[model samples]
Target: MAFRNGTDSWVVVMFFMIVVILFPLGVGPEPDILNKISSGVIWVAALLSAMLSMDRLFHVDYDDGSLELLVLHPQPLEFIVLAKVLAHWLTTGLPLIIVSPLLAIFLNMDISSYFVLIITLFLGTPTLSLIGSIGAALILGARRSGALLSLIILPLFIPVLIFGVSAVEASILGVSSKPQLLILGGLFLLSSALCPIASAASLRQAIE
Candidate 1:
């Protein structure tokens, strides 16, 4: 409803681009190094972008009192939480994925690695949205929720980061990125199943 008014979609896209722009300036414009680090940098920037926007996922609903209604509604809160997560990914992750190819080209990332880069994001960003739901829920009305949300969720994001970067690196090396891809897929599945339930429980506690 607030797509026109809300800045998150624009912010995330601009945030990802800004981060990508800064890396070469910070690291020097050496082609070899840029090419080598591009995948990792892209993944890192994308991760932080997702994290940056996560607070908006539930904080808005909580502030507006809609979250409590969903929590107390007849339908299970878990399912509602899942729907929110899905919507979050659709809005945030999808744009990031769509713009990533341009970032890859700008970073001098090899064309061969583009396939892996896109695949990893397709599998990994949704996992970010799923996992972030828990952190967002836990701090719905807490003091300094954004800072606390970062601390709580950054550690949890490491494995996804690892597998995601690894997949790109593997593809760059001309090796099969299948193993890392599979791990990310598994992590997404695990998070998709658990995070909504966990977030729902937290929301229920918060509302009660």
Candidate 2:
């Protein structure tokens, strides 16, 4: 289903690129300035990009009654929710990581920081998708869910963003980013354990 919606996937990637592109234009092309803010800018763009496609995470399933069927399935609904979240990350978060090196260049970030940036993103983006699944499920049938979903998830995303950018910045400063990366890893593990169950419960409620 995620692959079938190629346009939506591309939209997420485009939104991410545009956000990164705009920062260089708005902040001027000064390499030093761009370099300094690069980590934050890219991380923020990624967060927003992840948020962009979240509304549709289970909207289609809900509309077509697939959600009810999944909830009624013999297998656990949490596993089903986990699968959906995995699909969402593949179509959304993976693209951001793939294209981030080019954006880092646009922001004049150091080559040395690229690996750490990618590492942080690898650890952080899935957590975004995982945590986002809960919000997406919560707003399953709510009006103006896009806005409401953002409200529900944005605060939750802050910690991931903070740790992600901090890891990149630490790498750029020649400091070990291990601590931040470890924290990101922990966040990912925590979200992975919790979000699918929460999403499954919300989906059950929404379909009730």
TM-score attained by model 1 = 0.96
Model 1 over residues 113-176: C-alpha lDDT tens digits?
Answer: 9989999999999999999999998987799988999999999999999999999999888999
lDDT of each: 0.89, 0.92
Give per-residue CA lDDT, model 2, range 73-123, as digits (tens): 999989988888899999999999999988988888888898899999999
Q: Whole-model lDDT for model 1 versus the true structure?
A: 0.89
Stretches > 4 Å off in candidate 2: none
For model 1 the local lDDT of residue 204 reads 82
Pairs in clash, predicted candidate 2: none
Clash pairs for candidate 1: none
